[model samples]
Target: MTLFVALAVLAAVVSFVCSIVVWKLGLRFKLYPQIRERDVHTRPTPRLGGIAIFIGILAAFGAAWLVSSLGPDRFSLLTIVFENPAQVLSILGAALMIVLLGVADDLWDLDWMTKLAGQFIAAGLVAWQGVSIVSLPIGGISVGSSWMSAVVTVFAIVLVMNAVNFIDGLDGLVAGVTLIANGVFFIYTYLLVQQTSPFNYFNLASLIAVVLVGALAGFLPINWHPAKMFMGDAGALLVGLLMATSAIAVTGQINPAAAGIEDLFAAFIPIILPFAVLVIPLLDFGLAVLRRLRAGKSPFSADRKHLHHRLLDMGHSHLHAVLIFYAWTAVVAVGCLLTYVLPVYLGTSARWALLFIGVGFVVCAVITLAPLGRRKRLTVAAEEAPAAELPGVDELAGVPETHGPVTAEAAPVESPEPPNGAR
Candidate 1:
């Protein structure tokens, strides 16, 4: 745990510094493209933050490799790396490929077919390097033939990548949401490792989660509302790829029968946690795809009808919409994590975890729907008001009603047009 903390800190510092450098270089070189009609932000912003994030992750992995080579035998994290150099290298290589593909798309606006081809190649590379899912935790069922395992793993990775990228419409939405989700996932993985390999208490999944948490923490200051830069497609896709990898590394490798986890629900946590953490992104992605297909358009076609867009249309402020995402992510991710934790540590029934989830859902529903209720009330009040008492259009538009001629300074400035998409 101490070593892991040190590595996370190292990654955070490196990513922070790199982000600053990238931001400056972007401005100096005029690397950002013009703002599109569908973009939420007013100004053109750089989208190369993913390159810095990837560098930070790479640095952490490199440091881990060095420590594994030089450190003493007792450091189990070192040993894990030493034992699986091929797998580690493959993950990094795949990440590099993804970053390059994303950077090109960010700069050139590549077609969907081109992007999909790259995604499949990267996913296939990782699966071929033995990151493929071998079995399910459910009743110790295996995933069947090697070919089947590879196909399933590749498909899963691609699905997660797109799902995550679909929600990149808002500033800091992906970074903050990933931070919260991965934080909970890190805890779950660490606890699972302690139960399964008590002596070591270290694994690939937890390492990936912690490193991601650090990278996002470092990048988020710049990616926040009124962002200096966006993570763009590159960062979003990279995050999704790593997240899917981490889930597979932990979930696929664990043998429920050997781990002595008898409870059926407990055994399923490995499968459930990833979905629980990614519920929002997955939901948005699914809806978008279905909507586009119904309209006879490409599933990957861009639009302003995303869930976040709906929140903006419902009258939620920019900051409020982002916070709502964070809140729901925390509620769902932590709720699922507790289901695994309470049973193992407190000998309590899983029903307690269910109760927590139920209460959390109710709270989140209220927060999410509150804007719509407020809007409805405002509309009703406006409709019922007497015509004479109601302010005229000029007054409502910030022009003061006066008998005297208004000065230029006192005249209402035309409000800037709202961006087509939600922030």
Candidate 2:
């Protein structure tokens, strides 16, 4: 407990300092995001926020190691770092690869396929650490691995990476969601550690999860709407890679005995847990792909058709739209937890929850499709007059146009004399 608390405080401090450094460097270098046709923001903002987040995470891990080694206890939570050196190396290496790839994309626009290929390569490296899902649980039944499981694991990684990236569209959306997700993962994995036959990998996962949350919490204030900085592809992909890898580290590996169930059930629990925790990204990925396919378009194409865009279309301001999405994410997260721990009661809770969800959807739908208002602006003179004495459109009908440059289409049609000849 002391170690974890120290880790959190250390991480927060490192993140806060790194954020300041990154902000200063970004301003100096003029590395800012320009408004693109597809972008929602109308202003230029700094784009190197990822550099701060990455540095913060690395520094936090270092601090954790130092504290574990020096705190009178020769062996500490940081032993997980040395115990699973291969896995640690794999995670760091893959994160570096993805972050660099993303930074490249931000600095010099990379093609979609290029970034996609990079993500796959990084996931493959992480998987090479013997991290792969071998089974799953469905309705209390165990499902074991075949060729299908391998394909599914790889596909899940790819989808999760994109989902995290997709949610990065709004300020604070990805950061806030990432923080929440990691916080939950930290608690879940910590509880798993307390059970008999604890997995050391889970301990390492909690450390990383807390580190991620601390970094995001430190940076979110600057990234929030009316934002001073944009995370850009650099930060988004780093987050995606970190989250997918963390999920893989926890749920993708298994110890049959630790699962505490006979047959395949034990092996399935850990496998299912990661997916359950990442329900939002997984669901968003599925919805995005389905929507694209239904539109007869490539699923990889970018547009203003994301869920966040729909919320904005519904007349919610940017911040409100983001908050609404955040609320939905929290709801899904809570639902997944309920289902996992109390599978029987989840049905009843879900039924009640669905009503509120339906109401939310309807409200957003109505706001998006509603028409503009009917009122018109008038001059101060018109406003000063009594409401009943105000001049009607008919009273000012056929008023002569004010002088201005003629439009190209009307340049040749100017009359030789005014029709009223008042001039």
Candidate 3:
């Protein structure tokens, strides 16, 4: 646990520092595209944030390799940096491949089909590296053939990969959601790794989770509302692949049968945990497809009707909408986490705790959904408002300036005229 903490911190600091460098370099290189009507940002901003995150993850992995190889053997059972070097490299290599795919999409704005081809190819690489989902529990028994497992593995990876990509509608939404999900998975995996019967200290999945949390945490400040740069498809794909890999490692490598988890869902928890953690993203993706289908539009087409966009339409502030999403994600993911954890740690009392938490989540969500008249007025004003001329430097500095004419194309789209952030 101590060693894992150090590695996580290392990744966070490295990601933070590297992101700063990437931010500046992206601006200098002018690697951003012009603003689009369907897009969020009002002004041009860099989309190379993923490159920095990937580099940070790379550095952290390197650090882990060095520490485990040189450190005393006592801690050897706690880390696989020295013991499973191939696994580490394979994970990193898979992530790197996705990053490359994301980078291409971010820069070229590739069509959906081309991007998907890259995603499947990257997912295949992951499965080939020993992180395939080898089984699925249907009844009380495991069910899968070798060929079936390969197909299921690729499909699962692609599902998560695009779920993250499709949900990248608001600033920090994907990163923040994944960060929370990663924390839950880390705790669950760490606890699993603590068992002494079959595996006293096999924490590869835990390591991946914490490292991911760190990387996302380090990037969050820059990605918060009023973002300076976007993670683009590169960061989204890379992060999603990392998350999927962690789940695959546990499900494919570790046996829940050996875990002896005392729950109705114990047999399937390994397979179920990933979906539980990613419940929100998966729901969003599913709803999006249904929505587009009902409208007779291609499922891959982009739109402004995502959940976050709906919140915005309902007159919620950007920050408020994001927080609401975060709250819902926590309630769902954490509730799912407790399903396995509280049972083990809290025993019978876990049932009452789960019930109370569930109630609290519903109440909070209900209150958040309640609308106010002020917001409706604000929305109306924003829609009806005419564009105004850009304020001069003196006006910006709070010094009075003469009125100027607003350009047709440069006019404001909203009443308050704030920067447009993409969904």
Evaluated at residue 223, the lDDT of candidate 2 is: 81
Candidate 3 lowest-lDDT run of ten: 389-398
Candidate 2 lowest-lDDT run of ten: 414-423
Error of 1 at 372 (Å): 1.2
Per-residue lDDT for 306-384 in model 3, tens only? 7777777665767777777787777766766676666666675446546855885887577577555554554566566
By lDDT, rank the candidates, best first.
1, 3, 2
- Which one wins on lDDT? 1
Global lDDT scores for all candidate models: 0.83, 0.64, 0.74
Query: Candidate 3: misplaced stretches above 4 Å?
Result: 71-74, 78-84, 137-142, 196-199, 252-262, 372-414
Point out where model 1 deviates above 4 Å: 72-77, 252-262, 391-410, 416-423
- Candidate 1 lDDT over residue span 1-423, tens digit each: 888888888888888889999989998998787777667888778999998899888888887777877756656555775587888888989999999999998889899999999999999989998888888886568799999999999999999999989888888899999999888899989988887878777788888999998888889888887788788778889999999999998875455565453354667777788888889999999999999999999999888888888877776777788889898898888888877777779887777887898999899899999977865765666678897666554554335545456687676556655532222
lDDT of 3: 0.74
Q: Please, what are the lDDT tens digits per residue for candidate 2 over residues 24-96?
A: 7877887764556667766666766777787777877777666656743565445656566687677778778
Q: How does each model score on TM-score? A: 0.93, 0.73, 0.84
- For each of the candidates, the C-alpha root-mean-square deviation to the true structure, in angstroms, is 2.7, 10.2, 6.5
